[model samples]
Target: METGWRRVSARKSASRFRRSTSRSMEESTSSAWRVTHRLSSRDSRLRFLAADDSGSSSV
Candidate 1:
């Protein structure tokens, strides 16, 4: 009877650990995406500004 109870508790802990790991994985992925998007937009803005400056100087 004690062995059966221990088995059940072990399974419960394993499932909980798996759930937390997946949740963390999802959060990290989303944060990474946000950072990438921000960087890309900033890069595009910088390129645009550079182009504008060059065009004005040429004119």
Candidate 2:
């Protein structure tokens, strides 16, 4: 029946859409994690530099 064929096609389309959306979500999460890690590292380095400068000046 035509209705049966249409139902199968709809299911296939839904699955493909789900896969694409999942991939995009994964990529976005990875990028966000990388950005956050880089920012944290930069902040730590700045703190270290500030501390070093203060220590050197005291002498």
TM-score of each: 0.61, 0.60
* Model 1 Cα shift for residue 39 (angstroms): 1.0
Q: Write the per-residue lDDT of candidate 2 for residues 1-59, one digit (tens) a residue.
A: 99999999999999999999999999999999999999999999999999999999998
As a whole number from 0 to 100, the lDDT of residue 46 in candidate 1 is: 99
Which portions of model 1 miss their true places by more than 4 Å? 1-15
Q: Looking at model 2, report the run of 10 residues with the lowest lDDT sum.
A: 50-59
**Candidate 2 — what's its lDDT?**
0.97
Best by TM-score: 1
Residue pair clashes in candidate 1: none
Please write out the lDDT profile of model 1 over residues 4-58, one tens digit for every residue.
9999999999999999999999999999999999999999999999999999999
